[model samples]
Target: MSKTIESIFKPHLKPKEVYQGGKNPPTSNGKKIYKLSSNENPLGQSPKATEALLKAAKHIDVYPDQTDIRLREALVKDFDGQLNANQFICGNSGSEIIDMLLRAFVNEGDEVIYSNPCFLPYAVFSRWYGAKQVDVPLLNTTYDLDLEGILNAVTDKTKIIFLTSPNNPTGTYIPKSVLDDFFTRIPKDIVIVFDEVYRHFADAEDYISGLPYVTEGHNVVAVNSFSKTYGLAGQRIGYCYTTQTIANYVRQIHKPFLLPITSIEAAIGALNDTDFIAETVKTVQVGRKYLTAEFDKLGIKYWPTQGNFFIIDPPLPEFEFTDMLMEQGIMVRPVSQFGAPGKVRITIGTQEANEALVKALKK
Candidate 1:
């Protein structure tokens, strides 16, 4: 007998909530529209990256290097050779690499653990892969990850743990000492995926990246992207650092030439543009401080952030507050779907944009 469409697919497959990224606000009174919703680099892409991208455009007829040798080599130099090229796996974006990691490690009925309010992809992909998800809520008072709760949630069926530093929306980060203790307690067999796309913005002295754990040969993967820091969101390029064993496994599943040659060249050029990186970081840090001070004066409550954005407990409902901002020709994120209802996430923008946001809030 012929099979029906539903019969061909796995029974466990079910629809999940799609990610709702920041959107452009409606035009208002011919005023300048400042999109502070997406946490994008307001200064734009680096000059060096644009130059390299244009140069690589001439070779559009040829496929990119399947091995990603040149790009990986650039990464090696960027990290001062602490991680070998073979340990890196380039992807269309850090998001894609994360999906690949889930595909590589998770199987039907296996459990995946993560904080309740996290980068949505973790829950979405876990469900897609037929893995049971364990949602550990963040600490109520501080909106910080409940590491002790996560450790207690673990079981033999657990396959992976997703950790996001300077966590999205809330923007809280796990301190080095906290993470060190957490690492010692976690089972070495379970793969830990650390998303640190915002590490460059986390200037706190106690914050740390998962690179050290990776170097220690623990079952850890550090995922990073050029999107946030290098203004390469349009390029859709990112990479991960992990043990050679896991890298090989993920590479085996990844199709060849998944990244465009131009994107690869752009990332390499961005890595070389250290001056631009420093400038972007400084701009974000300054803007963050300015916004924080303004919020304090206004008696607004918000979590202390280590990323380019922070979640605010606004006077009105989250959507209401966001709509109010939109009417003023400003765009910001309403993160109820990320599990923080009645709160909004605002990205730190340029000095002009920051001033405009403050002006709107004061009115």
Candidate 2:
């Protein structure tokens, strides 16, 4: 509207892209869509967390704890039996954690190296901050990390490198030995961010989470979410553990009263409820196994998954296969967006939802 407003803008946002969220199913009175697109917990939010939210409803007039002291303390009790509170800064979502980290470290024109066909929002966010986003290909059909390619992608401008274990869409993870090797060659100054929202699903002994690296004094930010494991995505809660120095830097850039009061209470309740955590993991484990067996029986080619979602290279074009599924009121993500052009990423939902997809495929 004004020249001052126009002059303040940059070309990076000339055409801002919409973040592609998970599909919301239809209504006639809202028919439930078997939502397998986003790697959401098919089990729904934890009952204890829900109970806490309902109990906390009367406190809406009060502001949320700005520092999330209670939630941070809870995180310390859980993740910190090994690490500590000083290692973490809690946020509204895993995405918000990224925003805080970027604000804390990235300067204008710095280089950020992330895997191509990796997390889509990251590319958008990096460019928005005026940092260049470099995308490298997955080494094979599965989106496993290529340590050499990643090291080669790094440059003098590189500030951060993002690695997702049990990576989304394709569902492959880097083994500990490989990640150790990858970290060895990177410049000591460059920070590495590990997004492990789906780490709980991994059963492989070698499929390590990033906590070990953090313990060794590496410049790493390891953030796992309560949303996926505790089914609290609606509450938008996630936390990151970094070096105490990085945590201090991140705290300054974080928005005040960020995590809602009720959300924090819910997350605390979720943290305490170990029975629910065990049950959710078991249910997903059962569902994931059933889905894999069904895919194999159907003779459908699918990537071996260690996360909540897996990619299947369908017999048709990616969009065409997706359209067929959507018409049946089942929504799955097209893997083309993540660089697997002919595949679809299917979240392992309930036994029924997974079976429904298999039935749809049979047609």
Residues 1-363 of candidate 1 have per-residue lDDT tens digits of 888888778766645477776666665567788989888887889899999999999999998888787999999999999999999988999999999999999999999998967788898888888999999988878977898899999999999999999898789998999899988899978999999999999989999998898888888899999999999999999999999888877888878888899999999999999999999999999999999999999999999999998789999988889888887778988888888888888989899999999999988
Clashing pairs in 2: 27-30, 92-236
lDDT of 2 by residue, 166-254 (tens): 88767888899998887787799898999888998899889999888888888899977887889988888898988777777777777
The per-model lDDT (C-alpha) reads 0.90, 0.82
- Looking at candidate 2, the ten consecutive residues that score lowest on lDDT are 24-33
Q: What would you estimate as the lDDT of candidate 1?
A: 0.90
TM-score of 1: 0.97
Model 1, stretches more than 4 Å misplaced? Answer: 1-3, 25-30
Clash count, predicted structure 1: 0
